[model samples]
Each structure stands twice: as C-alpha cells, then as structure tokens.
Target: MKVLSDAGVNYIRIRLWVDPYNAAGQSYGGGIDDEATVLQIAKDAKKYGMKVLIGLHYSDFWADPATQIIPKQWKGLSDEDLNTEVYLYTKKLVNDFKQAGVTIDMAQLGNEITKGMLGVRMGNGDINVWKNEPYDTKLTNLLKSASQAFRESSKDTQLAVHIETPNMYNYDLIMNSLKTHCMDYDVLASSYYPFWGWGGNNPDNIANIEKMAKDKYGKKFVIAETGWPFTLQNSDGTPNNISYDPGHYQVGPQGQVDEMSAMYKAILSNDNGLGAFYWELAWIPVKAGWDNWQYNKLMGDVAGTGWASITSRGYYPDSKIMYEGKSASGGTSWDNNTLFDDQGHPLQLLMMYKGFLNGYESPANVTSSADIRVTKIFNNDNVNLVNPLKINDQLNVSDFLSDSGQEYLNGITGTKISDASLKAIFNDLQDRKQSKTYTDKDGNKYHYEFWLDGQTTAEKLNNFLKLNSGMKYGETLKVNYTATLVKDKEVPTVTSPVHVTLNKVYGLNNVTIDSPLTVGESMLAEDLANVQKAVNNVLTGAQGTTISGETFKNLQKAIPGVYNATGALEGIKVYTTDTGNHYIYEYWLTTDDIQGANKDVKFGDPINVTYSASLKWVKTA
Candidate 1:
C-alpha cells in the first residue's frame, strides 16, 4: 500500500471468493481470499490510508478467460436460481465490507472477466464453443445478477467491469454486449500485462484501445491489475541466467519501472482514463513467509532483502513525463520526427532524377524542334509525384485524366512519349493548326492536346501540358521537351506471403480454415471455429473497404500450423525440425502446483509464468 501510495496509486483491488471450500467439505488453506480474507485485506489497506476496490469472484474457486467454474455452494443451483445467488452474494459482500468499516471505493463483480462468470447454467446454458460466443443466457444471468447486486448494495461504490488486456477488436464486443444488456458499470477496468497480453507495445493497437474504451464506456477507465515480474525461472526449476536492462523489457528492476511508466503515460493521457492500481504488495518477497518463487518472486516488495533496489530506483512521476513536462536530462529530444510519403509511412528522401534546361538556344529552323515540356517530377521519396498539375483524388490514377496519368499518378511509374512519335505528332498538329480532344490508352480524357509558343509562361504551359498530353490533337510543339517524365519503372506493391506464429500451442485437428476468398486473411486451426467463420463472413463478397481490423487479426491468429515439442519442459519447448537453430519460445501456465497444494484456488486465481530462455537448436548435418 505504501509503495502504491508513494507511486501515486490510490486504490487497491482485493479479490473475494465465495465459500472456497469444496463439496467434499475440504477447506482450502492459504486464506483462500474468502469474504473474511477480503475484509481483512480491506481493513489493512484502509489502515494504511488507501482506497479499496473489492474484486468479487463469485465462484468458490478460480475464474478466468478460460474457465469460470461454478462456486461450490452454487453448484446445485438452477440457472434462474444462480442469478439470485449472484445478486445476494454481491449485496452481502458489499454490506458486510461496509459494516466492517471498510470503504469500498469500487467493486468488480467478476475478475478479468473476458467471458462472464459462474458460466454453467441449467438450460440453454451451454455455449457453442465453435462460435466463440458472446454472453449467452448463462453468462447474461450471472452478469445481470451481479450487476443488480452491485447496484443495490451501494450507489457510492463505482462498479468496474474488468476484462482481459484491451484488444481493441474484442473489447468492442465486450462493451457492445454490456451496452446491449444495459449493464451499468461505472468504470471500464482491464488487466494489462504486455508480456502476456497484446504481445507488446503496438502503437496502433494501443491507440485503438484508447478510442474503443472512451467511445464505448464514456466512463473513467482504470487498469485494475498490471505489473511485470523482475525475475524469471525456467520450467526446469533453475533461475534464468539472462538479466534485464534497466531501461527496456529485457527483465530487471529498471525495465519493470520503465514499463510501468510507459503504461501510466499512455493511460493518463487518454481522455476517459481514470487511474491504475498495482496488484498486491503482500506478494512482494518477504523473509519469513512463503518461498521467494511462491508468487511474484521478481517483485522487490516481496523479496524484502531487495528493498533498496526498488526504493532507490527512480520512477518518473506522471506529472513530469506527461502533459509536455520534461525530465532533468535537459528535457526530451525529438530527434526522430519524419515526414511520410503517399503511403503514410516515413519517407526516405533521395534524388533519383534531375534535368537542367540550357538557356534557350534559338531554333535554327521553324521545324528544328524538341518536345520541350515538363513530364513528371517525382518527390524525393519516389512514392509521391510533385508535378505542378498533379491530380488530387483517391481513385486509381487510371480513373483520372489520360495523358498517361495512370502511369504517373498514385505511386505509378511514369512513361515518356517516344522521341520519334513526339516529332511526328508535333508536325501533324502544327500543319493542321488545330486542337482536338484525345483519349489515352488508359481511358483518360484530354482536351486541347499539344504545345503552344516557346515564349509561353511556365504556368500556362504547365496547365496546358496537364491536359495536352492526353489530347488526341492540339497545338503542335515547335521545340522538343526539355524535361520528360522518365522512370526506371517497377511494379507497384506485390503480395508477400504473411508469416504468422502462435505464442501458445494449438492442435492441428482442432484448427479449421475459413474464408478462401480474401487472400490476406485465412484462419488455420485450434481457434474458436467461430472466429474463422467470422473472418469468412466478413471477407466473403465484401469489398476491401469492408474488411475490419478484427477480421484481419482473427485471420492472423487462425493461420494453420502445428508445434513440435521436444525436451523435458513438458511440451513447453517448440522447435521446427527443419530449422537448424530457430525455435518458438513459449511459457505455459499450469495448475498442478496450485491444485496439488493445500488449496482449491478459485477462478481468477493470480498466477505468474515466466520465460527463462528461447529454445536453441544446432546443426546436425
């Protein structure tokens, strides 16, 4: 609590499980964080002068994105009856906590609730797993009951609907479902651990998350629980020799601090963002309690011996790093600002072509002519054209005027009119002394095609040339073009085979392919088959404009592949036999220790899995 309060963290979330003891009447040890335990934590936290948020895990045991096991007491209850139980449980917990003199600033009816809690139901409760369903009757009843309980218990305590780390795409579904159900949640709470969720800091994804939360909830957003581990251990029960740098994600005190700083920075700036809460300080390493690796061994607060490292580490406060405030190191330096070209990417400026005009040499004869016209002038990036008369439209260049604009506009390669053809056309037009419209091979319309006088102003010539190049006939050129748009033509973008990797294992048989039409997105296997169906549903007969980011990411996740596990890491090591030394690194979560031990850890049981090393392979040949 002090660490958080010192770090500007005001609120703490403590989870509560209902009757964590089992049907067999076995009382799970370890406090089980039951109602009694939650109240105790709340009391302790308030004594420390910290705000408290009670996370009500309605189940007897753990609940998560994967499992929402029914509470032991509620197991025999019917679907309709379960809803009442949820409401009563929530109301009782809140009232009890209040009676205990603990002010509950906020309450989460469920924990990390990507899917709803108390998932099993009596009738129509089973979900079509293939569909990767939204809240069905069972989940709806549970949520509705919980929401009612929170609402009825205390109007002052804010209700937070906690979900998995914000995936801009899936978060929409959660918010939309809540809105559709009219579930009243005061704050949008999410759990974000970059290493496990959302992969890493993807700016596009981060921005999407901000937009989705602000747009959907229109309420304050808070990170309910988020933090990184400082130490990592291999599955083999050995300490990972690799150490983290202070400044990055490599794994160390500084890296954790940096990550926290970055996360806070991103969140506080979000208009709808409220604040964040650290998980638990009790889990911090201590000398006389559980083993160092019992929970968050990487945490210095838990590892009491390493208190100095954490206390001394500099944490750049929110007010200082955010809102344009600078650091003591002479303020921030923006050394990497750059301009993007037509494709909306950083442009690498380069001079590919340059043409100079020799001071006009008098034409010896009336017909001693050159195609004296400006053709194409490409920007340094070569992605954008810088001609004075360039077209401004989103359609393909071919859809615009002819003049071979199709070849020059829209990142297309430009072509120069052949010297012989230019001369012949110029002579014919000059003889006729007429201007006529012409349609180019690309089907663009050009009017008043041809050149005017050599003494014509550059502005007028530039305008005339814009259309003249596409005209069938117009004023003939008396002089040759001093600068013609020349290009060492290369084709536009070509599709490259997109490579996808799954951070976790998926069965080959469990995988299903969908959306055979859209080339960019295809779902492979082991994914909720419905996701593939969703991909196919959106992609089929849909134009490029209709394809969404969700559909695209789902397809990426669904790419069919099998992982080969070798060595004694209990299938945690995946290596492709063909690749000499390349392997996909993975860390798995197991319940064996937590389950085999003296406790029936409830749903939303906090567990930490750390990466020790990337699988290494050697050349056998």
Candidate 2:
C-alpha cells in the first residue's frame, strides 16, 4: 500500500470474502480476506494516506460472472432471511471497519454481480436460480438490503454497483436489466480490459458507455478493473488467458503505457467520468510453496521446509480452517501484468504512471525533408545524346537499379506514381542507406548516389562526367538536371507485440469407441484406445488448430464416461515411442484455470494433456 501511495497512487481497492473458513474453521489459502485482514488492510491504507475501496465478494471463495456461489451458512434461507442476512452482514462489516478507525471511502456492493449473486446450486444439477424468482425480486431484494446496510453503517462512504461487461456487446441487456430493477448506486463501475473486454480494441465505444452511464443513469462512471499482460506465459504451466493479436493492441511495457494513456484520455473525455483504477497493480509473484514447485517435493506434500511449510498452515489438520490443497507447481497468472516483476523490481510502467501524474506529455511529431535531383547520364561517343534525355524518355537503365532510384526517375519523367506507393518507397529509403549504379552505351561507367555519400543524384552524375571528360569530342557529355524536393512528416505512431505462449488442442471431442460404456463402469481397453486415438487425431489435426476453455468442456461432454481432460507438462505421456515427439501434452482443465473472460487460442499451438479421468460408479441410497 505504501509502495503504491509513494508512486502517486491515491486509491487502494481491497476485496473482502465472507466466512472464507471451511466447516473445520480452516481458512482458504488465497489471502482469506476475512474481517481481520480487511481491517488491517484498511488501517494500512489509511496510514499511507490512501483512500480505500472495499469490495464484497459475498462468498467463501472467488466470485464472478460465471460463479456466484452462496456462502455455506447462507444457503437454503428464505427470501426474507436472505435479505436480513445480507443487510446484517454488510452493516456489521462496514461498522467493524469504522470502529477500527479505518473509514471506508467507497464500497462495492458486490463484485461483478452481472448474473445476480447468492447463487445456490440445486441438487447436483445446474439450474437457473434467478429464473425461479419473479421480476428479479431476489436480486433487487439482496441489492436493496446490502445498499441499505451500507447506508446505515456509514453515511459518508460512497457506494458503487459493479458489473464486468457494461461496455461489452451485450451492454443493453445488462444495463437495461439493472436500470429497470435496481438503481441505487452512486457510481456505475465496469471492468474494461483491452484484450478481454467487449469491443476493447475500440476506445470510442468505452468512452460512449461512460458518457451513457453518466447521462442516462445519473451515476459517476469508473473503470473498476483493467489490465494488460506483458507476457502470455502463465506462471503455472497452463496457457495464459490474455494473448497478443497484431490486429488489435501492441504488447509489452510500451504497449501497456500507450494503452493506459489512451484509456485515461478516454475516461477524462467524459464530463461525469470519475477516474480509472488499475486492477491488481501490486500482485507480484511469490516464491513457490504449496501448489508451487520451489519448496514442495510433490503435489499436496505440505510437510516440507521453505515456502511450502509456511503455505501448509491452511491445510494443517489441527488448523481451524482447512483449505483444499493444490499442487504448488505453478505461479501467479497475473505476475506479468503486475506493477513489479517476480524479483520485486518495479517495472517501467511504474515510472510512466508517475510521469502521467506529473503532467508529462507524449513525444511530439517529427518532420523531415530531402532533395532529389536527377541528372541525364549519356555517352559522349554516342551521336544521339543531342538535347540530353527529355522528360518521359525511357532511360533504359539496368535491372540492378534500386527501386527508390527507379521510382524517383519515374517521378521526374512525368510517370504517375501513387502518393501511397511513393511514401512507402520514401519511408523504406529513409529507414536505411541505399546505392545505385548505371553504365552508358559508350562503355564508360557512371555512378549515381541515391543515398550513399549524402550527395544528390545530379551532383554525383555531374561530378563523374566532369572529372572523366569535360567537353571532349568523343567523351564530352551534356548534363541536364531537374531538382525535385520532397517533404515528409508523421505524428510518431509506435507499436509493439506482447507475446504469450498458449496450449491449444484440436478434435478434442472426437473420443468414441465401438462399444458403449456405463458412466460408473470401469473403462475397457478399447475405450482407452479410443481416447488415445481421439487425442492423437487432435494432435495430428490441422497444424494451426486452436482450442478454448469451452472446447475443453465440450471434449469432456463428447466422451460419455470421461469426466475431464487437461494439458500436461510432459505432453502426451503415452507417445514416447514416437521419435518425433508428436504427442499432444495435456492435463485436466478446470474452469478456474482456463481463460475466464479472455479470447481463444491461435493456430499451430501444441496442447499439453496433463490428466484425463473416467467416472466411477457409486452406490447411493
């Protein structure tokens, strides 16, 4: 918090989880932002003279558009009970912070409450919980309760209703739904990521959304979370969520800086635009521990020294809260997007932000000029060199002539060359030095300087002719010159690519065999062969075939008995016999690990198959 505050960051947003502890009272491993953690963070932010924005997840774990699971204790409650639970929970949380001398400057009612929060999974099947309620009663009730609770807790703290896809292609459906039902928010916050957000490549649409929210909804517009990755390589061995596409935005530090500048400009363009917050600016990578490979010898082995031992606290049997253990073999996915690198070193973007705050402007446009002079080169021994070569007269130059020299000669001779083509040739010439040479019909050699020696074409031609032969009978030559001045200028547009490695698969859904199998039955040898064949087909499919998280899910769906499939670090472990390493490596892919809001894969990407599993039949009463 102090690091950010010193770096000109004025606001710090902290997410709070409700009852992150399991039934055994063991806390979840991912920061477990309970009351104590929230209080300490708020207090630290206050000490650092930074405003605080507290985000309520209203779940024991991460909450977003796809998953908004209800807290364990709050499940099966009636509408009235749920409303009361929400009100009391929010009110107490805010009041507790107030009593701890940490005044909340802003509060997000719910984190990315796009599909409605407090979702309860019915039985073991997927069902629409919101559809069960009439007129969005449950959603509005929960929002009203949470909002009223915040108001009752503190009158000064501003309230914001957050959504993930306001500027997305489905803006009307989301915003209209919210406006029709719930409209008690002081700030309308939206998440905008250039690589992930809807129409993110187009800044005008985002600005228009900001203006629309302000003008139509009468609410202050703020970009709640936005980030771009410098590298696509995930710290964990899995593929990165965000990838760089040349058609859209550039990648790396300069790309990040430029994107930030453009976003800031767009935000400030609107009248009621408050400001933008960079999401997870301080989430640097830590040493490997539990689920991390640096300290642990194997997955789920917590009884080891170093970072693993420290991370083992959450999974200890005697511990109050027992966190579900994960293999500590991977690293943070957002480390590349953070303000600091893995070594705690500040990145170039940190200083760029400082410069932005200090009112530094981007570089100015550059303008330059060049003189092009053409000299008619002829042989003094030739009788046809009377009036020198006139305009539109073909020079019959050698095929070895430089393109720029040819184009310049073409331009001087009244031959039409499009401005675009001329500019392209000029730009290429300006990029580097070039040389051109020509010989007359009399066997005398004449050299012309297109760019080398910094001499004009006419000067080089004249100097060669004057030094070799001056008005001689058989060697004398008449030189005719035409001075062509060209001017060029540009506003200095720059671009770069941020490369990200991705694990892609193809034909993942083609797993089928001759025999039918039961869901709970053990897999036969033929089934395994079919699975291998399907995977091999994907491996040997079109070279550039790419897959997405949805595709992985569909692959699971295609195989009747197979529960899941994922990319492995070692790739297809069964294809060791193939000397060419043709096997596609993969592991069991989960929704939590795949690209949540980002785009899909590209062509020719090799996939990693880590794990695949078939379901086992269970006897139930």
Candidate 3:
C-alpha cells in the first residue's frame, strides 16, 4: 500500500464480503474481506493518504456473470426478510467502518451484478429470482433496501452499481432494466477486457459508452476492472481468458501500457467518467496448495481445496496440495495480467500510471491488425500436381475439411509420387475396406477409405515408400508444406513494439540458476544451454506455460561477454497434434545489450547456436 502511494496511486478499492468463512471457520480463498478485514484495510489506506472504494460482493464467496450463491446464513429467508436482511447488513457494515475512523469515499451496491444478486436457493439449487420475478420488483426492492441503508449510514459516500462487458448495448440494457424497476444508482461501473470484449476494445467504443451513460441516464461511469496480459501463460494450471489473439490485441508489457494509456484517455475525455481501476493490481505468485489460513480453510470446507480446486465437498479427508504451493485445481490465472511480476516486482505498466499522474501526454497510436499465421499440410501426393503447393503461399479454400486422415497424410508426406509403380505401391498400402465420411464447411460430405496400417500414418507411408520405391533413406522428400500469413480480419488492432531499458540499478548477482550448468567450450555456451533447458522445462509444465522476462534476462547474462541483455520473445506458436496435445514449435527472441559480441542462433525449443564469439578486450589506463 505504501509503495503504491509513493508511486502516485491515490485510491484503493477493497471488496467486502458478508461472510466468507465456512462452518468450520475456514476462510474462502478470494480474500477473507469480512467486515473486520475491510475496516483494517480502510484504516491502512487512510494512513497512506489514499481514499477507499468499498465493493460489496454481498455474497460469502464470489459473485459474477455466472452463479451468485446467496449467503449460507441467509439461505431460507423469505423475499421480504431477504430485503430487510440486506438493509441491516449494509447499515451495520457502514457503521462499523465509520466507527473505525475510516471514511468510505465510494461504495458499490453489488459486484458485477449483471445476471442478478442474492440468488434465491430453489429446491434444486441456486436460481436467479430477479430475472423470473414479476416486473423485477424483488431485485428492485433488494437494491432499494441496500441503497437506503448506505445513504442513512453515510450520505456522502458515492454509490455505484457494477456490471460486466464493455459493449454499450449491454450497458444500456442494465441501466434500462434498473430504471424499469425504479431503482436509483449514482455511478455506473463496468468491467472491460479487450480480449473478451464483444467487438474488441475500441477507444471509440469506450468513449461512446461513457458519453451515453452521462447523456442518456445522467450517471457517472467508471471502469471498475480492466487489464491486459503480459504473457499468455497462466500462473496457475488454468486457461487464461485474455491472451494474445492475433488482430485483437498484442500480448506483452508494451501491449498493456498501450491499452491502459488508451483506457485512461477515454475515461478522462468525458467529464462524467470518474476514472478507471486496474483490477487485482497487487496479486503476485505464491506457493500453491492448501494450508490452515482462513482463506485456505474456507476453500477446504466449501470445495475441499484452494481457490482453483475443482472438487466436491467431503470428497477428500482434507484439502490436498495440488501444484507448486497452491490448490491443485488452479490458482491465479490473472497473475500475468497484474501490475506486478510473479516475484512481486513492479512491472513496466506501473510507469504508464506514473506518467499519467505526472501530466505526460497520453499514448497515441492507431489500432492495426496483426498478421495471422495459418499452416495447412497436404498429403505428399496432393502437392503441386493437384493443389500447387508452396511455402509462404496463400490459398483460399471455399470448402475445407479438417479430418484426421487429411492431417495425418500431411504430417507424413505432401506430394504424390508421379511414377505409376510408386502410386501403385502407395495404393496397395492403404486399407480400402474401411471408409470414413468427412464434411466440408458447405455441408458437402466426402467419403475416404484409404488408410495405412502401422503405429502411425507417417510410419506406414514411410515404410511402404522406402521398401518399394527408389527413395533413399533419410533423404528430403518434396512434401508440400504450406504456410499462410494473412491479416487478421476479425480483430484488426495491433499495438506498438515494446521498448525495454534496463537501468542496471539491480545487480546481476540476484540471478539464480535452477538447473545444473554444463561447462561447455565457453561459459557463454554453457549458460545458453542451461537457459534452454530451463525454458523447455517450463514449456512442458502445465499447458499454456509462458516465458517470463526474468528468465529471459538470466539467459542473456549466461552468454559469455555480455554486459546486459533485454528483449522479449514473440508469443508461442501452438499446434495441436493428433493426440490433442498442444505444443509450441517456434518463437523468436530479439536481443541487444551486448558487451562487444553479436551472437546468432536458430531459435526453437532447444535453441541451436549458429555463431558465437567473445567480446573484444578493452584495456583501461
């Protein structure tokens, strides 16, 4: 908190949960943001000369676009009783904060209440009563009760109704629905992510939404949550919702800076746009697994694991450690998108905020599309003779069928042997009795029966060709490998390249080599080899693993004769094999900060060194 204050951050938004503990007194992992915790955080923020924005989740755990489970204690209350309960809870929470000498600058009525809040637990399970109730009266009454309590407790605190999605249509729907129910709210809050936005994150779209909220509804608008990922990899063993999608947005530190700069401009452009908050700015990597902490215990009781645990209650005798030091199910998927690195160090994005506070010009760049790389493999026999295949070639397929057999043949060989005897041999290797149907995009189905018998299609084909044909072993075959680089049409926004500058304020001694470093012909070569090993280790970890900047720096230092190194690798190129396993085959790293030598290498999983040399000796007087 002090670090952020010193860095020019003036406000901190803290979420308050009604009751985040389970029957066993275990805390849910989201943050035991109970009344006491909220008050404590508020007091701490006040000490740092920062204002507090209180977000009331109104649930024991999380409440979002999906399930909004009613607090367990308030499960069986009648509709009227539930309204009264909400009023009382809000009033008490406000009074508690006031008594603690903490002033609440803003208070959110509900957290992302797009679907609805306080879901009524039907006999079967939790259901959204707000959507089904007559005229949305129940939801209106509940909001009115909570809002009135907030006003009675502290009339000065700004009240906001939070929702998700950056689309203006969704914003209008939420506001109109509230108006129809005769509910009042002072601020309109929404969550925005460029990758998840319906039409992509357009500055114009954000500007229009802010303008519309003020003009049409006479309400202040604020982005409660917005962020971009520095890497596509998830710290936890879960899939990241926001990643580097070609044409949609760039994925890296610079990309985040660009997106954030644009967002700030859009918000500040409108007088009614209060400001935006970068969600989960302080989240950092931690050891995975369950412990006796309140949050961990709650996770154990509720779901029998940590926050990422995907298990049932009473399934395990106790919460078992899943991975690293967190839950086995998954941990923080947004860690990469955080303002800090995995090691809790501030990222380059923090400088963007500093620049904004210092009155620097907002980042300016027109959005452009990224080139999408598409790879399609054809059978060895179906190359130039039939389809005219070539590398770096573009082919428009009005009708395309992606089948196992097609991909398999492409994997083995691409061109058909022109010789009649070779063609006969290939035909003899196929299993003509078995047939399978494949459908094209146009609903046209084609039947295929030819299949080679072996451990793999490639092996079978290779064996047949070698035994019957004059092909030499280990010789390169003219296989039509087609790769297409086309501009992304769906999302046509590309961010500027990232410019990195290492101040060298931190010494290189902090670098820790995890694996053994083999002493090769040179220390630089050994370091490069060690770095490659570490990288491959991470890539083969949980799916979606990404390379970190720290790891990249360590590798550069390993290079002999290099004073400093700073560069970033392009996003990993992923391809799914026949067994449905995704693997990265290629990526490039741009390097600089050499002492006096330039090194070249073929970048891949195990980077191949094509050239190496030591820096020239410099003599000092």
Candidate 1, which ten residues in sequence have the lowest lDDT sum?
Answer: 349-358
Candidate 1 global TM-score: 0.43
* Candidate 2 whole-model C-alpha lDDT, 0 to 1: 0.53
Total clashing residue pairs per candidate?
28, 41, 20
Model 3: worst 10 consecutive residues (lDDT sum): 365-374
Relative to the true structure, candidate 2 reaches a TM of 0.52
Predicted structure 1: lDDT: 0.45
**Model 3 lDDT tens row, 1-621:** 888887778878888878776566756655557788879888888999999899988887667766466787898899989999999999988898888788899988888876677873333333433455552577778888999998888999998999776767767876877777877679998887776744736677888988988999899988888888887765533334565553455777677887888788888888998887888887654533111132333343454233433332222213332445444433454667888866576766776666764465433322111111123423423222322334344322212212321222221122333344344334433232222343444544343322333446567566555643544222232221132222112322221112122222111142222221221332233333433444453223222223333344544544322211222122122334344444321112223322112222112223222222212112222
lDDT per prediction? Answer: 0.45, 0.53, 0.56
- Per-candidate TM equals 0.43, 0.52, 0.53
Over 416-468, each residue of candidate 2 has an lDDT whose tens digit, in order, gives: 43444333333333211122323444633333222311257455444434433
For residue 519, model 3's alpha carbon misses the true position, in angstroms, by 39
Better of 2 and 3 by lDDT: 3
